[model samples]
Target chain A: MGKVFHEIRDPIHTFIRLDNDEKVVISSRQFQRLRCIHQLALTFLVYPGASHKRFEHSLGVMELAGRVFDVVTHPHHLSPEIRELFSQLDTDEKRSYWKKVLRMAALFHDVGHLPFSHAAEKELLPDEWTHEKITKHHILSDEMQEIWSNMTPPLRAADIAKLAVGPKEAPELEFDDWSTILSEIITSGAFGVDRMDYLLRDSHHIGVAYGRFDHYRLIDTLRILQAPPLDSKGEQSREPTLGVEAGGLQSAEALLLARYFMFSQVYFHPVRRIYDIHLKDFLCAMLQGGKFPTDVEGHLSFTDNEILVELRRACSDNSLSTSELAGRIIKRQHFKRLYERKPTDFQKNEQAALLIKQALEDKYGAENIRFDSPFQKGESIDFPVQLKDGSIESASSLSKTLNEIPVVKTEYVFIKRELEKEASLWLSNNKDDIIMS
Target chain B: MERNNQRTILLGMIKSLKDNKSWCGETHIQKAMYSLKTITNTPIDYDFILYKHGAFSYDLRDELTEMRADGFLSIEINPSPYGPSLAISESGQRLYDKYRENVSQYDPNIDFIATNLGAKGVTELERISTALYVCKKDNIFDIEECASRINELKRHVTIDLARSAASDAYKMLQEYEKHSC
Candidate 1:
């Protein structure tokens, strides 16, 4: 009686609906290829239950987008153009289409995500390149376009895909805005759907209680306020703005708390970081040694299994005694969870990095010492929230939870046996040189 | 200083104390004045007599002397009684608290919930029940017991409340995982 739609039961979002275009996209060989992509990459090595794929997460995001659209567009008189999009839905079919588009967006959101997730990208690429850029390329590639051709309003598939990633310069559409939307779909802010979905989803999968929230009330409170541009001595620029009422401030507050709890409770968990670091190191070694084709970098078409295969091969070839280790990790045999400490001051951090680098070089030699600063640029985009006063503010400014929500910077000293015995001594001796948890 | 400039100076002073965690004596004040010029990229006068010193000086002790007499802050002067050695007044603490309070209000619960619940109607006890089934292993709970609780609470609470309570219950069970361990 509520709504009869094609609902794909998901761990994050209970049910993700597939639109006609989304269905086509999802059914496509290229889109389905995302099923092989793990959302958190090598994070599963840290949190074994984090084995969910980008495909599943994308579906979750799509479902979340549909929920956002419902809240943002309804209760207020929607513009005719916006209304036209939803005109056909007398039944769930109409609703299903919206769900599908969002689903497709969510699914492909991380399609360009590298092997072992962000870790691989951090190790391999320069600072300027992003997973989103790769995602855009794959979506526009011939294989995907061929599949996209079958979608309803197929002509817009490319545009939407382009919209999802956005451009560097201030093109017709800013990547800032689209990326903002995408980030909202993924990260937790006042009203980010990604946070919304993951809170419930991660809680469900990880068997934790702290990630639950009032999902529907949040949707109802997504108020849209109108605002004018700052052009003086010209025709009044009228643009309808988005906001959630001050009364909904508590909901926003609750969201920030949940994000903090999740981070403390789940994401930044020490075991997860270690697992990720090992996977990252393994992949980097393989890529650096030219053991695999660089085409993987270009296409990035490898699945979780393919990465594991290469990792296993590398361990064997290097006489690394990591074959059993690789098998356990690939098979979800995970490590014990450890600490999650808030980051220290920025100056202290830089100083710590410098000291750690020096210590590593002193003990393990420059070539052997590898320091991976995972907090590279463009990692966490600020979530923008429309305040009660109708002005858009960055979530960090609005919420205190993010004030010291440490930018994940991991410094790992891969200790071979020769240096293993000295590693503890070096770490103890150089405590002031590095930021300890 | 003009009111705006004075306010800015006061805020900057408070921030310096908060971040640097040190008392701004004469030497610290001189250093601050120099650094402020560098940071602002502006040329400003550094010599000004603080009322407490009853004369112009480059030392922060002079400024603190005048500010204290004006009640801008309350401080315990050194044995020389020239400048404050430590402690901020109620007014300074008020300014510090304002920023601190604003920053401490962040909560991610709403965002987490919204994205996870698809189509946004999963709020009532019945809906919560459905969602519960999806989140949990099929045979983990005694469905009958959960349903009875839902029925009893159906008239008393909103769906959101129901979902929250049920979620908490589930979380408690999961947190105390006996079988998996």
Candidate 2:
């Protein structure tokens, strides 16, 4: 219990407390690896203040999750029925469930992330894999199991991992059977603790106002609207209404707007896109060349510093050229935003991009243009809002503002050419052909 | 003429010249200027007319040659007797059409002229015969010249509407050809 006070200062929430058992997890070399992982990945290049580490971001997430639980179960403030519902779970199961959610969400949020978040995701694994899958693999691997064994609290890490993915993949490992509830709260629905924390934390560290919101009011408003049924079938029927109902329509609307603003102002910033591309290029080059340490390949486990060191080693061995790129990035030297053009036809865009790549290669000496589609998927942000009567309504349907903003994806890419002047001249020359409308 | 109105006239003139299969010359310029005045509903400025129509500022020769080298325009940049000439390659036509549409959407009012300017500067061919002649005569025998010529010939003889290289490519060429002559 005494160990839980180990203070982790977060840009958004300030100091986050790590429990004694959790401290064992945080202090583990595996957990400490997060220190080198930038919470926003390549966003630092765009937002100078966004150099915050994943370690702190994870802690902030953990803290927010804890707050969510507290808000839902506050004895004096929450409905007695919901508080009583929480009390039904044994201490061990409750702790395990909470720990699983907090740790998994914290670590896995950026797992799907390539070296520089979405930038790398687009370049390295556009059609193959996602950062979420990568993070999911890490949590499910034998290595994660080994880390789980070392913890003093004796958590069933495998069980937690199963809960992280929900029963769709690993039904045998689920103990608490709260997979649906956890998944909905963690990944989807408006009031998920993940967004609540990241919005504030990212906003604060990245020095943007988009993340600002009434977090405390949000927390205070939380109340579990539906109860988990005694049977699987019962749980199925009641799943949709299984969330908190504070702030009603107003808070939910604000969260949606907050997400929209974050995408526009912070996540989609052009400089961040450049940083993401370069970093991913560096990592992809290393990953493909079999240069990553034997322990980290296919299964990654390293703090932010270890990643930097590995990059340095790769450069020293001439397996990578990260340093040269790093110098440019650290100085905020970025690739220019030439133009934003939508693909006339998705199919032709692919073929034409290949031709463009060949054209650039001939002119610039080697591979320079990579095809990217960042806005291919319509990201769902429908947060389930529990009604006072124990029914659930999707935030989008309940709020007029949420429904009005149709998801308009800006699908384009950031091109890093070997010859900027020549490329621009060429683009200027062939503006009609190359620029998508 | 206002730049916007001048561009539409230029595009119309280019289409007419291509239809006649004539090199960009006095007649093409005269028609383009007349179209510009008609579109603008006023007397067109001569400088705007000349600049927009590739009269003086743009070295059509240099632009055409560069496109050929880059494999974008694919036309040969050669000085013909009818002033400077342009033959849009399949690639060049595709690019020209694309630029024209882009300029139109970017600023619909001025897009006609903007598209013409972009096509002239970026999408028009330098000279197909010169490019082919250089490659064939020099025995360097680059296939690009022949490909551009084939594409240009297709544009010259066949407007089979159905068989036109994708609409996007045709539109781009339409804008480029508008300024070429």
Q: CA lDDT, every prediction? A: 0.47, 0.47
DockQ of each: 0.01, 0.01
- Superposition error at A272 for model 1 (Å): 2.2
Candidate 1 lDDT score relative to the true structure: 0.47
> Residue-wise lDDT of candidate 2 within A110-164, one digit each (tens)?
4433343444554465353555555566665676667666665555655555444
10 residues in a row with least lDDT, candidate 1 chain A: A228-237
Candidate 2, B-chain TM:
0.29
Q: Best candidate per DockQ, number?
A: 1
- lDDT of residue B164 for candidate 2: 28
Where is model 2 chain A poorest over a 10-residue stretch in terms of lDDT? Answer: A230-239
Per-residue alpha-carbon lDDT of candidate 1 for residues A1-437, written as tens digits (9 for 90 to 100): 53444668765556777644566667765557677767666665545676776677667766776667666646352444323333333466655454444445556666666665666564465555566666776666777777666665444355556445533311223222223333344332246565577677776667778777767766667644322221112222122234455455456556556665776567655556556755665565555452323332455556677777776675455366555446435554433221112235222342355466566677667645444333222222123345545444434344454443332333334434345556657666666546542
TM-score on alpha carbons, each prediction: 0.55, 0.56
The per-prediction i-RMS, to one decimal, reads 25.6, 32.2
TM-score of chain B of 1: 0.34
Q: Give the residue spans of candidate 1 off by over 4 A.
A: A1-5, A75-103, A125-128, A166-190, A226-242, A288-300, A313-350, A366-422, A426-437, B1-181
